[model samples]
Target chain A: MVVVSLNNVTKKIGSKTIIDNLSFDVHAGEVFGFLGPNGAGKTTTIRMLVGLMKITSGDIFIDGHSVKANFEEAISKVGAIVENPEMYKFMSGYDNLKHYARMVKGVTLERIDEVAELVGLQNRMKEKVKTYSLGMRQRLGIAQALLHRPKVLILDEPTNGLDPAGIREIRDYLKRLAREEDMAVIVSSHLLSEMEMMCDRIGIIQNGRMIDVQLVNDMVNGGNVSYVISAKPIDQAFNVLQHAFEGINVKMTKQHLHVEGESVDVPKLVKRLVENQCDIYEVKQVNQSLEEKFLEITSEKGGIA
Target chain B: MGLLANEWIKIFKRKSSYIMIGILAIIVLVAAIGMTFINNQGTETGDNGNWKTALEAENKDLKEELKSTPGPYKKEVERVIAENEYRITHEMPRVTSYNVWTFMNGMMGLVDIVALFTIIIAAGIVASEFSWGTIKLLLIRPINRAKILLSKYITVLLYALFMLAILFVLSFILGAAFFGFEQNQPHLAYLDGQIVERAQIPFLLSQYALSSVGLLIFTTMAFMISAAFRNSSLAIGLSIFLLLVGSIVTSIIAGFFDWAKYLLFANTNLLPYFGTGTPMVEGMTLAFSLIVLLVYFIIFLVVAFWAFVKRDVAA
Candidate 1:
């Protein structure tokens, strides 16, 4: 089900367009990643989605309510953290959650405690947010956004300032929330690898316009899968694979042979290398990362990469 | 209501608010202690025992001066003569010792301190959110912009009232503790050739309310500046600067321009109209001042709500 939909939403600041005719839908039980480089209007789009900024033209709907006409109803179904989780440093972590919970109805103290545990901050909830590290702050922010049990959770640059472990923790936590709560999560990030592990589907935006939207699976291994073979005498292995698998795209890199083919053909190429008396030291399947896919998509559109 | 509680809690969580209240309380205690020490020096007037005869002689001399000089100071002299005659007839002593009522009256000036603290809160209540980058999360709540802004504005006014209560109640308690309620007389006023007598506590309370009219206006101005600009320093500085000098500037302008009657400070002190005193400008009536104040109050609120509701949360 489409939990949130942006129908041709446009945002213009003065004469310059910040987000132009952006359109997409986020479904429940799925993590949708908004990917783009810096200054690609990713943050602006998130701002409009949560009603922080106005849409110059077009409309956005959240849970069947129009965001422009019925803002309170639409936004009530969403919990978002735009930019950094800049909370009141003087207030304790629990107090910050309570503060946000007070803004919405039906949030009891138990719910506040439950969310604190969900974010793994229950032990430190009474401590001031100033004492929290960036990771703890991010978790507290997520905990705040979840207090109201919103149907949609939108986080812009959720991993902007976290170490690898913290980033992984957030990624796994978000994925679990999306699956267990059946909530639609929208995460925007410039890091391709993070999105690959976190998002189920992604929409790539560039220069205030969406360039591509696809399932993460199709985006990574939709067309061709590459295999990297590091063997003795790389040129011999390269020629053996090129001759055995006719019309296959094979390249001879330094000390390795890169072969582009299906998984079924990778083993066949490896068998032929051994039959031709070439040493098969190692053979590994290489999945094209979302970063390369992004470059490929941009280059296909003949735009600036 | 929830929003208001949230804002109220947010304010008290900071140390600055406690500091403000502490400073105000200390000022009152120090001022009272200073007065107590000065009065302990036994600076009693020699004429206190025969003040009726002294006032009678002063009235005779004032009547003589009234016959000789006729100028702008004439009305002041006439007012003094009328008050002296009324005092002598009523047997009210001019040189009374310090009492609880007098202490309460003296503490009325401390309403300005309450105003300063209130303005500090008003200035930061809205602007600090933006500066901290918390406005992004704040604006994303289920509440609409108008409701949120209204809650914040109401919180500021409530804070002003709370500070005023602290000042009044604390001063009253302190005054009663140090200076007993001995020989407290009714407040006397010379109004239109008549001596009006008012009970002391009611008179003091009304004086406090009248003084706080200026506080309320200055706090609202600070709030408006805070919402329009995301800089608490600018709001606090500008509002405080105006609060200190607004009336003085209005008086300077009133000397040449009659339209100065419409200035906010000219109308803030409603005590003149309530009690027996001349208006800041000659032609300003009670109704006229109230209307001017109402207009400025509305203008400040309208600008505040407009800026808060209409502007994009870019910061």
Candidate 2:
């Protein structure tokens, strides 16, 4: 089920368009990653969804309520952490959560304790927020956001200042939340590797426009895959394959000949190479990582990587 | 209602709030101790009967001095003679009594301290949320923006009333300890070209309530600044500067411009209309000042709520 939807959302501040006619949907029990370079309107879109900003033209619906008209109803289903997870420095972590819990209904003491343990902050809940580390504060922020059992959770740069272990911890918790709680999670970040590991699907945005939205595996290895051919007499094998697979792009790098095609064509190409007096040693498929794919897509759209 | 409670809890949790309360308590204690010392000195020196005789002597001296004094000094000497005669006929006690009326009357000075602390809290309440980036957390919740702002404003007024109550109870306790309890005392006021006497308790309570008119206006001004500007230091600095020098500046301008009567500072003090003193400008009546205050009060609230609701939380 689609828990969050943005329909032709556009935001203009004075004459400059910040987010232009953007549209997307996030389904329940899935992790959706929003990817963009600097100034790509990722934060702006998140702000509109959370009702911190007003949409200039279109509407954002969360759990069947419009953000522009039914703000309180729409926002009740969303729990977000925009930018850094800032909180009252003078208050204890537990007090901060309790303070926020009062603003929403049905958030009892047991719920607070449950979230605290979920975020691994049960031990440090009594300490003042000023004394907490950045990672600890981030955990506490997530705990506060989860108190009311929101249908959708949004986080912008959740791993911005965390070490590797902290990043892994957040990534693990987000995945668990989506699978166990059946919640839709929308996260925006510039860290491609982390997003690659954490997200099931990603939407690329640039210059207030959404470039594409696709599944993570499809985006990385869905289309034409490249295969490296290691055979004897490398130059001869490269020429034979190029001639046999006419109009198909092929290249030779050092000791191997690279061919681009579907997995089904691998046996046919091998048969042809064998018939051309070339001995096939090994054939390996080259799978592109999300980082390379992201660079390729963004650069194709005239954006600096 | 829940929002207001949230704000109230947030305020008391901060150390600075407690510091402000501590400073107020220390100031009141020191003043009470000083008054006690002065009262003890007066009693130790055996000056119990000197007040009446001294007033008589001063009355004779002032009457003689009025004959040869210059035009400017004559008005001052005649006023002194009138005050001395009133004290003699009314049998008013000296300052050394430290009675309930005296203690309550002395509390007028502490009102300014209350205003100062209240202004500090009011100025920082909204601005600090933005400065600390906690405003995003607040706005993302299920509450409306107007309710959030209203809760914060109400919290400030509640805090001010709490401080005022503390001052009243503390002064009453100290007054009873120093001068024992008196059944009936008259509070004297100069009103309508005559000296009118009123019940001490009601008169003192009115004085305290009237003084708070200025306190409320200044607190509203501070809150307006806080909501309009996201910078806490700027809000606190500008509002405090105005609170300290606003009246003096308005008085100086009133000399050159009669239109100054419409300024906020010129109308905030309602005590003059209650018989404690005279209005700052001639023809400035109680109803007129109240109307002026009501207008400014509405404007401040309108501007504050409008700005807070319309502003996009971009940061």
Candidate 3:
């Protein structure tokens, strides 16, 4: 089932359109990544889905319940962490969970403990949130969002402030949650590589519009192939590769030439480079990283990523 | 119901709330101790003073009447003796646990501490969400916005109740310890309109209790003010300012207009069961105060709910 659906959702703040007729679906058990740059309407869309903000136009549905008409019922099925995870900092982590647990239905004390364990905060659950590190706070946020056993989890930039290790832990944990727990997760991030690693499908949003919705494999074109040609006198190396490989694009960085072409084109280029007395030190095909893809999409609309 | 329980937990969980309770306790203790010392210091030390001379003259007149009585003057003599004994021992007019409470209640105006505390505590009852950046978290909880607001208002009332209960207990304990619970034998005869002898002490206590209900209404009005204004400083500041200025405004307005009775704070203490034992005016009844408060309470609650649910959590 589609756990969440936005049909042409549009929202405007004053004269600026923050979310422009965006549409997407989060299926059950799928880790969906909402990829966008800053001000690309990722938070706005999530806020609308969670009923924090009204939709200027269009409709949002959570498990087939209209967010506008049946907001309470719709929002009950959703647990979200928007922007930053804010909680009662004076309360212990366990107490914070307990406090939020009461707001949700059928959330038992046992479930609270379970969620704490799931977020890897079981050891420090009794400690005050003020004493928690930023990573622990992020985990606690996830735990709070997951406390009610929500069918859909919407987190915006859940891993933004974390160190690399913290990021990996959250990524692995969320992936496990989606696969094992059968939750449809909508994770928003500016870092496309993280999303690519964790998300099964991604919705690329830019300037308030959902530019594209595709599987991770399709977004990368099964990780689009690129060739890096390194030959002495790099200016000549670029001319040699471009002439030999027609219809292929080339961009020159300081020490090497980056060429986007077929994987098979590398050997042909290497042979030509040696023949032209261009000292060929490296001829390698590089896979386009998710960061590169994200930049390509968001940069067109002037997004700051 | 679970949500309401959650709201209650929030009140107990925050450290600031406990601080508020502690402040209330301190205020009550200080007031009780200070009043006791002042009262003791002001009493006449010597027996044969000016007050005694006047009393002796009155006693002589009453004795003359006893001599005129041909039948049993024994009862009259006993009554006069009791009166003189009471006069000599410092009957301590208006001094019971309930009377101290009334006196302390009046002194609420003199000291702005309780009013300050009420504003500080009650103002954040609703508006704290904005300051703490918790509005979005609270709104996404799936409960109705009306319930959210009602829950907050209920929490503030609970705080008020808890504070008042603490003050009541502390005052009584301190008052009894210092003043030595003197049976509170009613001495003021014909209080307001009713006839009274030395046997209506329990009745007086009950009347004071009824009168304190008026004070509770005043607290609720402050709660509504806090809820209406979402900023703690503004909420607390405005409510206290209005409270301090309200009586002055009432008297000033009354100087020009008569409809000032409808103003909420004017007749908040509806049962002035203190001085003269009756309401200043015939119409300033407890029921009238309650009705006006209910109207204001409903309006304030409606506005709080509407603002909470509809206002964007932009922060």
Candidate 4:
């Protein structure tokens, strides 16, 4: 089910368009990653979805309620952590959760405890937030956001300032929340590798515009992939493959000769190399990582992604 | 209502809130001690025996001294003689009398301290949420932005009322301890060119309540600044500076221009209309001052709520 939808949402501060006409949807039981460079309007879009900002034109609907008109009804379905997960420093972690729980109905003590244990903050729930580490504060923030059993959860830069283990812990927890609780999760970050491993689908945004949105697997493995060809008489093999695969890009690296084509072309290239008196030892298919794909797509626009 | 409770819990959890109450307690205690010491010194000097005879003697001495006093000092001396004669004729109690009403009256000056502390909290409540970045967490909830702002404002008013109650109850306790609970004392007021007497308890309570007008106005000013600017230090600094210097500046302006009566500070001190002092301007009546204060009060609240509701939590 589509849990969150943005339809032609645009935000303009004065004359400068902060977020151009953007549109996307997040479905249930999946992790949607919003990937963007700095100043790419990722936070701006998230803010509009959560009602922290006004949408200049268009609509955002959470759980089928329009955020612009039915803000209370729409926002009740969303739980978000924008930018840093800043909490009341003087309040204990438990008190902070309790404070927020009061605003939403049916948030009982058991629910609070359940979320605390889910976020792995059960032991330190009594400590003041000012005494908590950045990772601990992030966990507490997630705990508070989950108290209401929101249909959609949004977190901006959830892994920022977290250690490696902390990052892994949050990533693992978010995945569990989506699968086990059947909740749609939207996270925005600039960290590519984390998104590559954690997200099922990603929307890449640049300059207030969404450049592309695709499944993680489709993005990395669905294009004209390159194959690494290894053999003896490396210079001759490279020349034969270059001549055999006409109009296809082929290059020889330090360790192997690289040939770029669809997966089906691999066998034909190998047979041709064999027929050309070239010794072919190995033919390995190389899949591009999301980082490489991201660079390629963003570089096509002539700026940093 | 839940939002208000949330804000209440947040404010009470801070250490500064307790410190504000602590400071008020200490100030009241010190004032109590000082009043006791002065009363003891008056008793030791044998001036506490008969206030009527002492006033008559002082009146005669002041009149004799007025003959040789310069023109500049004559007015002050004559005012003193008039006050002493009025006290003697009206049978008003002596200042050295150990009574609860007198102590409660003395504690009225501490309302300024209450206003100062209340303004500090009021100024920081909204602005600090933005500065600390907690506003993002707050506004993402199910509540409306106006309700959130209203809750904070209500929390501030509740804190102010709490401090005022503490001051009143603590002063009552301290006063009853230092001086006997002497009821039925008439409060003397020099008004309309004569001395008039009214019931003490009601008069003192009204004075305390009336004195809070200044407190509420300054607090609203601080709150408006907090919402409009979202900078805690600037709000606290400017409101406090105005609170401290506003009266002096108003008087300076009032000395030169009759239009100064329309300014905020000119009308804050409602006690003057109750015969605590004369009006700053000649024709400024209690009704006029009350209207002026009400107008300013509405403006402050309108500005505060409007700014708070319209502001976008971009940061």
Candidate 5:
């Protein structure tokens, strides 16, 4: 089920368009990653989703309520940590939770403790937030966002300032929250590898626009297989493949000529290469990782990042 | 109500709030004890036995000085003479001894200190959230921005009242402990060109309330600045600077301009209408000052809420 959606949302400041015609949907029980480089409107989109910034046009709906028309009702179903999850540092972690607990309805002291334990912050909740490490602060922020049992949880740069182990811990917690609680989680980050591990699907944003959205598995393991041909006298093989695969990506890297095409055509191409008196010593296929694909997509769209 | 409680708890949780209260208590104690020491040393001079004769002699010297006194000091001399003549005719004895009531009366100057600290709170209430980067978390709550801003404003007013209450109750207790009580006394004053008598406590409280007009306006201005600027230092610095120098500047301008009567500081203090003093400008009445204050008050609140609710929470 679609739990949250942005419908053609655009944000403008004076003559500058910060976000231009962005649209996406986040489903229940799934982690949707918002992947983008810095200054690519990742923060702006999150801010608009959480109602911290107004959308210049279009609207967002959360759980069947329009964020623009019925903000309180729409936002009530969403728990969000915009930007750094900047909480009151002077207050104790428990007091901070209590402070946010007072703002929403039906959040009990029991709920507070449960969330703290879930975030593994139960032991440190009595200490002042200023005394918390960055990872501890991130956990406290997540604990706060989960207090209301929101149907959708939004986190902007949730892994920021975390150590590798801390990042893995948050990643596991987010996945469990999506799986066990059946919550829709939208996480925005520029950490490509982190998103690949944590998210089932990701929508890549660039230059205030959506470049592409795809499932992580499909993006990495699907579509054209890239064959790297290491042949003797490679110049002849390069010329033949270059002329044969007219519209395909055929490029030479070091000793191998990389030709991206359908797997069924590989044997035919090899025979043709053999006909040209080219010796194919080895033919290996490379499954592009999400990071490589991300680079290709972003660079193909524009060299903005 | 929950928001108010949050804001209140936030204020009181900090050590600075307690420090403010502590310093205020210390000031009252030292002032009271010092005044007691001075009162004991001069017992013979205020013996009420020859008080009328002493006042008559002083009045003769004052009348002689009034003729040669400059224009600015002339009104003060005239007021003293009028007060002394009224005291003799009415047979009201001079305040020859300190009483708890009088001690409390003198301690009213500490109200300004309350205003100063209250201004700090008002300035930081909204702006500090931005500086700390907590506004993002705050504004994302299911509550509307207007309600949140209004709650904050109400919290500021409530804090100011809380501080004032502490000052009043603490000063009252300290005053009683320092100076033993006499009977509830009446305050002597010059009213409408004649010396008149007023109830002591009611009059003193009214004076305190009236003096707080400056406090209330400046606090509101500081809140507006905080909402608009998102910087506590700017809010605190600009508002406190104006609070200190605004009246002096207005009086200086009042010497040369009639329009000075419309200025905020010119009318913030409503005390001039009650006793021996005159209005800063001719033809300005209590109603005029009230209307000016109300206009400025509404303007400040409207700006504060407008800026608070409409602006995006980027921080």
Candidate 6:
């Protein structure tokens, strides 16, 4: 089932289109990463989905309930931490949980305890939130969000302030949540590697526009190839091979030829280069990373999103 | 209901709430004790004689004045004499716990100061959420914005009630401890150039409690200001400034302009039970002040509710 859906959702702040014609679906049991750079409207989109903001001209539905028309019911199914999670600094973590739990129906004390344990905050739940480290506070935030067993968890930069271990913990917890709880999790971040490991699929956004949405594997799969071919009489061989494959772009660095093209013509091109008195020594396809794909897509639009 | 409770817990968690109540209680306690001291000092004539002699001197002056005045004022003079005679015969002029109660009752017009604090406290309750970057966690709680705002208002009102109740209890307890608990002595008041006294002290004190309802309404106005401004300093400063300016301007107009009484603050003091003091203007009445205040109160409430529920939290 689709847990949350936005159709043609547009948000404008004065004349600036913050989220223009933005549409996406969060299906049940998937860790959907919302990847974008700063000022890319990632937070704005998440805010709209959580009902903290209104869409300029479109429908946002949570479990089939319209966010605009039935905000209370629609929001009840969504657990989100927008921008940052804030708790009363003076109150203990347990008290904060108790206080937030009241807003969510049927959230028993046992459920609060369970969530605290889930977030690994069982030992420090009695301590004031002001004393908590950023990472601990983040875990507590996640715990608070899950107190009501919400079907959809929308987190914007949930690991923004966490240390490496904290990020790993949150990433692992989110993965477990999607798998064990069957929840649809939408996490936004600027970190590509983190998203690559945590998200099953990613939607790349830039300049308040979603440039592309693709599976992590599909995005990084075979998009780049680095080849090291040795050709003797280097200067003359480079000229001959360059003229034979007019469409192919080659870069000669040190002792290697890095050729990036369709794999289908690579063998033929290798034969052509050899016929031109080019003695090719070594050739290999370099693995492309999600970071490279993210950079390529985001840089095309100057990283506005 | 759950939201309201949560809001209440939030309000109580703040240090300002306790500090406000503590200050109010101290003020009420000091005022009660001060009145008792004044009452005691006035009566302990010692070698110069006692309270009875002072009362006799006052009575003598009134008698002398009555005798000197001519026929046209005779009826008024006779009425004053009758009331004075009753007070003297019944020992109603003596100060006791009733006197402190009566004194506080007379000063009830100043209770609007609570409204100023109410605004200051209530404004920060929600505004601090944004200012301190806590609103993000609050908004993600799967609750409607309207409910959140409503809960805030409820929390503010509870704070106001707690402050008032603290004041009330402190005044009564301190008054009784310092001033002997004498119920037979009448509640003393200087009205219409005569000392009018009530038969029941507790009943008069209870009647004075009605003024607090007006105070509650004023505090509600403060809450609205706080909600609209969303900054504690701005809300508190502007509300207090406006309130002080409102009173000063009303007084100035009443003295110079006939329409001054029409200003809501001019006649806010509702202690016209015996109808002694002149209102700021000719037509000014408690009912008229109440109507004008209510209108402004409703407008403030509407704006506060709307802004709190609709405005964005940028922090």
Top lDDT prediction, candidate number: 5
Q: For model 6, what is the alpha-carbon lDDT of residue B125?
A: 73
lDDT of 5 by residue, A147-211 (tens): 99999999999999899999999999999999999999999999889999999999999999999
Candidate 2, CAPRI quality class derived from DockQ: high
TM-score of chain A of 6: 0.87
- The sequence of per-residue lDDT tens digits that candidate 2 reaches over residues A173-194 is 9999999999999999987999
What TM-score do all the candidates reach, one by one? 0.94, 0.93, 0.81, 0.93, 0.92, 0.86
lDDT of 6 at A115: 93
| Candidate 2 lDDT over residue span B157-202, tens digit each | 9999999888877877777776667756676666554566688777
Q: Clash pairs of candidate 2?
A: none
Off by over 4 Å in 6: A222-224, A229-248, A264-284, A299-305, B28-42, B46-116, B188-210, B273-276
lDDT of candidates 1 onward, in order: 0.88, 0.87, 0.73, 0.87, 0.88, 0.74
Candidate 4 lDDT score relative to the true structure: 0.87
Over 4 Å off, model 1? A229-246, A261-264, A267-284, B60-75
lDDT of 2 at A197: 90
Off by over 4 Å in 5: A228-259, A264-284, B60-78
Task: Find the 10 residues in a row with the least total lDDT in model 4 chain B.
Answer: B70-79
In candidate 2 chain B, what residue range of length 10 has the lowest lDDT sum? Answer: B71-80
Model 3, residue pairs in steric clash: none
- Encode model 3's per-residue lDDT on B234-300: one tens digit a residue: 7777777777788788767755665776887666664453333333234566677678777876776
lDDT tens per residue, model 1, A1-305: 99999999899998999898999999999999999889999999988888888889999999999989999999999999999999999999989998999899899999999999999999999899999999999999999889899999999999998999999999999999999999999999988889999999999999899989999989887977887889887777777777776557888889888877554476677778888889988888887887888888876775854
For candidate 6, what is the TM-score? 0.86
Which residue pairs clash in candidate 6? A40-A305, A207-A305, A230-A281
lDDT digits (tens) for residues B1-315 of candidate 5: 888888889888899889988888889889889988998887776566777898899999999998898665666688888888888887876787887878887888888898999899999999998998988888888999888888888988888888878877777787778777666568777776777778876777788887788889889999999999999999999999998999999999998999999999999888777774667877788999999999999999899888988888876
Which TM-score values does chain B get in all models?
0.93, 0.87, 0.70, 0.87, 0.93, 0.75
